[model samples]
Target: MKLRTFPQGVFLPHHKEDTAHLAIVRVPPPSRVVLPLSQHTGAPLKPLVQKGDTVKRGQKIADVDAFVAAPLHAPVSGKVAGIEDWAHPTLGRFQAIVIENDGSSEEFRYDPLPEDIESLEPESLRLFVREGGFVGLGGAAFPTHVKLSPPPDKPIDAFILNGAECEPYLTCDHRVMLERAEDMLLGLRIMVRACGAQRAYIGIEDNKKDCITHLTPLVRDLPFPTEVIPLKTKYPQGSEKHLILAILSREVPPGGLPLDVGVVVNNVQTAAALGRMAKEGIPLVERVITLSGDCLKKRGNFEVPLGMLLEDLVALCDGFTTPPRKVVMGGPMTGITQATLAVPVIKGTSGFLFFAQNVGKPEHSCIRCGRCVLHCPMRLLPYLLGRLAEEHLFEEAETNRVLDCVECGSCAYVCPAGIALVHLIKLAKFEVMRRRKRGGK
Candidate 1:
């Protein structure tokens, strides 16, 4: 069978074999955790506890009234050591609530879901999602409840479960699909009910043959109709717009979302988290993350606490085999590079990658060969956008739809001239968003 895929995506080395077969292990809880309120994309949550306050595992620690925000919970029983500015993996520095482990994983009961969820309304399902502190585990950490609740005007007819895990050197989703297929299906059904979607599909890349083989049979018994789609292994195949096009052949307009095309997409890990939250009463305190690269001797996937420090992971993995060159929070294609080891993992963290040797090549002038344009999944003119941004022509870049760039680094990765096309585009995107916020056209 011809596998489905979006057009014009670049092929990657995958780099997932080292940890692909490994089972998800639970990391020993760290001595300390720093729960940042800014884990989600919306407004940062307000701290509900102060210094010296006692907290229990699965206890709600912080939240906000913003509809777009997701609540945060404590990962382990502890005392609030401090609530102050601290280093963040993605946000640089943010106000974080630091907790010192009390040695007793003091328990709070999380009641299991009722015998059935069919009796629940969409709003009720979203409430459960928010109560569990769920977000997109695929990274970006967009509040799951918000995604589940779309505008009434734009009804979602299809739900796509993103099992693609297309980014290289990351296999947590693959492991989740293979190991927790039942839970993932349960979560998908819940999400489908919440979104009022009539049809569902799980899209996995062809590279993960094991996941497809494992999930196919389990997906048969879902409450709603669902099919597993084996996708062509392509860069950014897991992204929302791309997956929607691959599965449904639908196009979400520029600056629009998947919902605009009568669809909603959620990651496999996100679905599993929701399912676990419902069935086992497991709050979203811990997440399965991949820690693998050529730099480390111990490479595998593990269930890491939400706020565990990077230093703890390094120590648990027995540290690096050689001097670390670059550490990233996600996959190389779209992950953020970390400058410090003091930062804690947040809700959206899927992998922590370390490379022994610096992979960067020297930057060069654009040769106008247009490899970036040819391979770009979004089909934006990256060369012109890069040049316009480099020349400080923000208006021209915006006019050319530079804001549509997903910052996937595809342009830069395929550039023969080694031009930092994504960097320039990122700068332009930032300025464009800033100017728009200031009421500029």
Candidate 2:
């Protein structure tokens, strides 16, 4: 059978053999955790507890009134040590609530939903998800409840479960699919009901044949029509837009979202987490992450507390086997490089990659190879956007639809000139968004 995929994507090494088959182990909480208030994309949360306040596992610690934000919950029983500035994986520094683990194993619980979750009202399910502090585990960290509640004018007909763990070396989703297939399916059903979708689909890359085979038979019993699609193993196949196109041949317009195309997409991990939340009466406190890289002594998938420090996680891996050059929080392609290990893993973190050798290369003038344009999944002119950005021509870049660039690093990976096309396009995108915010064209 011909596997489905979108056009203009590059296939790279999978780099997943090291830990792909490993089962997810639950790591104990560190001595302390740093919970950043701004982990989600929307408004930053305000601390609900001050210094010296004792909190239990699964306790809500910080939240805001914003509809687009997810609340923060304590992953372990602890005392609020302080609420102050700390190093963030993506943001340089942000106000974080530090908690010192007391190891009492005490927890706060919510009334778990009935076994037949579909019997519950959709609005009630959305409220439960919101209160549980669920977000997209697929890296965007957008609030999950918001996706469940689209505008009435835009009715959703299809929901896509993104099992395409296409990013190199990140196998947490793969492990989740294999180990927690039932929970993932349950979550998908809940999400489908909440979003009012008529049909559902699971898109897993062909590289993970085991996942497709494993999930195919299980989805047969779902209340709604659900199919497991084997996508062509391509980088960024897990991307929301691309996955939609691959599974349903739907195109999300420039600056538009899946809802515009009458669809919604979510990571398999996100669905599994929600399933667990409903079953276990727990919120989004801990998540599975891949802890593998060339420099680490140990490598495997782990269900780690949300705010566990990177340094502690490294220590659990028996420390590094070699001096590390670059540390990234998430898959290498779209992950953010970390300057220090002091930062804590947030809801959006998928994995930590440690490379022994520096991967930076000297930038050169674009030889006009046009490799970036050829491989750009969004079909944007990256070379033109990069040049326009370098010249500070934000208006022209925006006019050319530079904001559509997904920063998947396809252009950068294929660039012979090492021109940092993604970075330049990112800069242009930032400038364009800033100008629009300032009421400029």
The candidate maximizing lDDT is 2
Q: For candidate 2, lDDT tens digit of each residue in 1-441?
A: 569999998999989999998999999778899999999889999999999999999999999999999999999898999999999999999999999999898999888878897788999999989999999998999999999998999999999999999999999999999999988998998899999999999999998999999999999999899999999999889999999999898899988989999998999999999998888889999999999889999999999999899999999999999989999999989999999999999999999999998776787888888888889999988999999999999999998999899899999998988888899999999999998999956
lDDT, model 1, position 344: 94
What's each prediction's clash count?
0, 0
Q: Candidate 2: lDDT of 421?
A: 86
In order of appearance, the predictions have TM-scores of 0.98, 0.98
Task: Please give the lDDT score for candidate 1.
Answer: 0.90
- Model 2 spans with C-alpha error above 4 angstroms: none
Estimate every model's Cα lDDT from 0 to 1. 0.90, 0.93
Lowest lDDT 10-residue stretch of candidate 1? 107-116
